[model samples]
Target: MTRPPAENQELYRFSTAERWVHRTSSTLMMVAIVTAAFLYLPMLAELVGRRRLLVTVHEWAGIALPAPLLAGIFFRSLRADLRRLNRFGPQDKGWAWRAMRYGTRAAGAAGKFNAGQKLYAALIAGATLVMMGTGLLMWFPHLSSLTWRTGATFVHDWLALLVGVLVIGHVRMAMKDPEARHGMRTGRVSPAWARREHRLWAEEEAEKQAEAESAEG
Candidate 1:
C-alpha cells in the first residue's frame, strides 16, 4: 500500500528543527544583503541613505542568524547533511560534470544530490567562514595592520560576490523541483519523492525497518 501525503511515512529528509533553522538563517541573511546593498553599493547609495541604520540592521541580523545554525547541530538532519554535502565520491564528480552541462534541464543521469549541490555546499561552508572572519576584522580594524585591513576588505567583498552567485544557483535548483520546496514547506515528503531523490537513504531506512521488525518478531 502507498502512503498518503498526511501519513507518517518517515519520508522527511530534513527534520522540522532543521528546516526552521535553515529558513530563519536564510531569511535574515537575505534581508541583511538587501539592506547592505542599498546602503553600500555604489549605484544604490544615494537611494538608501543613512549608513548607520544599515549597519545596525546588518549587525543585529548577523547576531540573530548564527543561533539557528548552532541549534541545528543537535538535529540529526544537519549531521546527515554535513556528511552528505562533504562526501565527494567518484560518482559525485561525474554527476557534477553532467550537471554543469544540463543545469537548466533535469540531469539525464544523476545521483541523489548532484555535483553542483555538493560543490555549492562546500563553497557556502568556506564562504561562511571567510565572511565571518572578515566581518570580525572590519568590526575591529584598529587591531590589524593597514595592509591587513585592506586585504580583509577585499576578501570580504569577494566572498560576498561568490555567495551571491551560489544563492542564484540554489534558488534555481529549488525552483526546478516543486517537491523540493514542498518538503521544506510541510516538513514531509511523499514516500515516492524520497525514494526518487535519495534512494540510498531510502534503502538505509528500509534496512533499519527490517532490523526493527525482526527484533520485534
Candidate 2:
C-alpha cells in the first residue's frame, strides 16, 4: 500500500491486538443483534422457521461477547486503554456536560477517547453483562422461578432494543468522522487529526516518540 503524505504524517494509534479485539467483539455483537431480530420479531421468527437454532446462536453470541476483552487482557495497549476509559477525571465530566449541551462543537481537552466515547464504552460493557445475565436466566428457565424467568425475558428484550439503538448511534458518529474510523480500521491516524481531536493524547504520544528518538540518538 502507498504511504500517507509527509505533510499528513500518521502515527500509530491502536495496536494490532487492540484492533483485533475491536474487530472480533464488533462482529460478535452484530451477530447477536441480527439473531436477536430473528428471534424477537414475530414475523421474522415465523419466516425464519428455526426458533431453536436462532435462540442457540443468540445465546452463544451474548455469552461470548466478553471473550475478546478477556483475551485482550494479555495486551498492554488494550489494558492501558481500558484504564483510560475507567477513570473519569474532572475534565471528562466537564467535557461530557458541555458536549451534551452543545454537541460535538463543544471545545474540550480529551485523551485517546473523548467523554462521549468513554461513556459509550462503559454503557456497552455494562449492557453486555446485563444481556448475558438475563439471557442465561431466560435460556435456562428450569433453573429459575417462572416469575424470575419472565422478568429476565422482559429485561432482556428492552435491553436488546436499547443496545441496538446505541450501536446505531455509535456507527452514525463514526460515519460522520472518517478520520476516526480510519484510526480504528488501520491502527494509525494522522498526527494532525490526532492533535485536532485528541490533543492530550497527541502530546503524550509525541513525547514518547521524542524520548524514543533521543534514546536511539
Candidate 3:
C-alpha cells in the first residue's frame, strides 16, 4: 500500500486507540441497525424468517454498542477527546451559529472537534445509552411493567430511526472531506489542513510542540 505522505508539519489528530474505538463502535452500531431492521421491518422480517436469531443478535449488539467507548476511557488520549467533546465554550457557540448559517465555509477557528462534531458526539453517546436501556427492557419484558415496556419499545423504534438519519448525515459530511477521513483512519493530518479546518486546535498543537522543543533544548 502506498502510504499517504504526512509532512513533518502534520499534526497528530487521533491516537491509534481512539481510531480503534471509533471503528469498533461504528461496526457494532451498523450490526445493531441491520439486525433491528431485520427484526422490525415486516417484509424483511418475513424474508429473513429468523426472528429468534435476529432478536438475539440485535439485543447483544445493542448491549455491546458502548463497549469500545467504555474501553477507550482507560486511555488518556481518549479521555482528553471525551473532555473536548463535552465542552461547549463561547467560541463553539459562535461557530455553531456561523456553521448553521454558512455551512462548512463558516467552520471558524474550531478546536480539534468543531461545535457540530461535539454536539454529534454528545447526541450519539446519549442515544446509545438510551437505546441500550430501552433494548434491555424490550428484550426482557419480564423486567418491566407492560406500560413501561410499551414506552420503551416506542422510544427504541423512534430513536433508532433518528440515529440512522444522524449517522447518514455524519457519513455524508465525512465523505465531503477526504483529509478528515484520513485523520480518523491514520491518526494524523497535514498541518495546512488542520489550520484551514481547525485553526485553534492547530495553533494549540503548535504551541505544545514549541514548548516540548524548548524543554528538550
Candidate 4:
C-alpha cells in the first residue's frame, strides 16, 4: 500500500529534545511505579522475594523521575511547552467547563497543551514532589519520628495508586489518538490532526509557516 506523502504527514509538533525528555521521564516514572508495586503488594513482594533489591531500585528510580524535567529547562521548545502548561486563559477555562459537561470531544480553540493536559501535568508534578518527600522520609527513618514516618508511608502509598490510575488514563487517551502518539514519537504530527485537536496552536503554526514562506519568497 502507498504511504501518504511526506509533506502531508509532516507537521512539527514536538522537538527531538522534547520527545527525549518525555520518553525518559515516562520510562523512569514507570520503573518507579513498578518497583513500588513490588514493594507495596504483599503477594508480589513474596513472589519477588528480594525486598532489599526492590526497595533500592524504587528509591533510585523515584530520585531520577524529575531528572528529565530538570534537563528540559535547557531546551527552548520544552521550556515553551512548560509555559503553555502553566497558562490557563479564558479559552482554557471554557474548554474545561465544556469538557466536564460534554466530555473530551468538547470543541474549543485549544492551544498546544489543552486544559486537561495542563491539569494532568500539574497533578503529576505535584504528586511526584509528594512522593519524593514521603519516599525520602520513609527511606531515612531516623530523619523523622515514627508518627511522621507512618504518615509519610500512608501518603506515599495512596499517592502512588492515584498516580498509577492517572498515568493509565493518560496512556489510554494517547492510544486513542494515533497522531498525537506519532507526534511524540517522531517529533511531528499531521497538520490536519493538529487543526482538529488544537485549533489555536494550529493557527499559530500556520501563521509561522506563512511568515517563513513569505520571507523565503
lDDT per model, in order?
0.71, 0.86, 0.86, 0.87
lDDT of 1 by residue, 24-134 (tens): 978987876787677668898787757888878876775566677888889887877777777876655566556567652344333446567777777876777777777
lDDT by residue (tens digit), candidate 3, 120-209: 998999999998899889888899999999999899999999998989899999999999999999999998888789877887887787
**How well does each candidate superpose onto the true structure, as a TM-score?**
0.83, 0.92, 0.92, 0.92
For residues 1-217, what per-residue lDDT tens digits would candidate 4 score against the true structure?
2222234656788989999999999999999989888887888887896788888989999999999989889989999989899989777877767887887656477888889999999999999999999999999999999999999999999999999999999999999988888889998877778777887787787777777767899
> Per-residue error at 191 for model 1, in Å?
2.9
Q: TM-score for candidate 4, please give it.
A: 0.92
Tell me the tens digit of each residue's lDDT in model 2 across 1-217.
2222344668888999999999999999999999998887888887886778887888888899999999999999999999999887766867877877877646587888888889899999999998899889888888999999999989989999999999999999889989988999999999878877887788877787777767899
Off by over 4 Å in 3: 1-8
The alpha-carbon deviation from the true structure for residue 72 of candidate 3, after best TM-score superposition, in angstroms, is 1.2
Candidate 2 — which pairs collide? none
Please say which candidate is ahead in TM-score: 2 or 3. 3
Candidate 4 deviant stretches above 4 angstroms: 1-9
